[model samples]
Target: MPADAARTDEEWTSLGRSVLLRQLALGARSRHQLDRKLAEREVPPSVASALLDRFVEVQLIDDAEFARMWVRTRIAAKSLSRSSLRRELAEKGIAVELVEDALEQVSDEDEIEQARDVVRRKLRMSADLADRTVREKEMRRLVGVLARKGYNPGSAYSIVKEVIAGAAADAAEGAEPEG
Candidate 1:
């Protein structure tokens, strides 16, 4: 919302509607996010409440659906972990129950794969290193990466080990001469 724009609307309902639509045009927003934005814009609570109820009435605002979509997008685009996704959705003002439910969308296998994917991309650069200590150090760093992305230590260690072994196998295969 522009700083100079006056939110003091004699017709409060229309003002809320206009502001909401403008925000929505920019991107999909959660109901909580919209409420905050309206408050920041100085819209009256009564008007904001009325407008929000109407939006939800028309399916223009759905927190449950928003949580689901948000989880899916972040997982696909950023490979976030279930715990990380849950925490993020909660921060976004989605209900804790809905956040947990949305986090369920990422299966355990998907979580493992996401961890593997993170470590796999980093493993290639460390693949041919000669120092065992240096290679293990690099693997630890990769594991830390997964840990920050919300994998438990065990899962992170397992992923790091798997990717390292797979990279080694690929290197060995590539080095062998044709029979």
Candidate 2:
């Protein structure tokens, strides 16, 4: 028989604990993520449950805290909209209530500003803003960027329009000759 098949429940539990600790050492993980890892390692269901339960009892596994931190970090790093972040958290097995609670941290105004900031950065890097055709293309691309980042269509279009208009006005002013 293989070594795994010969292992007792205690040995399996020990393996499960070590797995959890190693994973935790790397970063915070949702309970479901940990459960999947244990299952992947072929740890027995009972042993895995007991170990996971113990970890929860000791406060080592708090999905709420995990969800909050994940939301904060993702927003700061990627400026993702709540819808996109919600989808991501769901994929990680975060509970609906926790996901909603975490999403609450980002207000509508905050999301708008983030989108604006992203559009501004992209606009600055665009070299052909002086040409109408290139400006239109850049506007389309900026709207697409916001769409891919999960911003609603209406908001994305409006933000891009506002930013591009402001940039155009500034450029026109800069091009005028001194009186």
For each of the candidates, the C-alpha root-mean-square deviation to the true structure, in angstroms, is: 3.4, 1.5
lDDT of each: 0.83, 0.92
* C-alpha RMSD between model 2 and the true structure: 1.5
Estimate candidate 2's alpha-carbon lDDT, on a 0 to 1 scale. Answer: 0.92
Question: Number of clashing pairs, model 2?
Answer: 0
Per-residue CA lDDT of candidate 1, range 77-157, in tens? 888898888888887899998888888888899789878888877675635645688778887888888888888898899
Cα-based TM-score, every candidate = 0.87, 0.93
What digit string (tens of lDDT, one per residue) describes model 2 on residues 29-71? 9999999999999999899999999999999999999999999
Candidate 1 differs from the real structure by a C-alpha RMSD in angstroms, to one decimal, of 3.4
Worst 10 residues of 2 by lDDT: 122-131
Candidate 2 off by > 4 Å: 124-130
What C-alpha lDDT does candidate 1 achieve relative to the native structure? Answer: 0.83
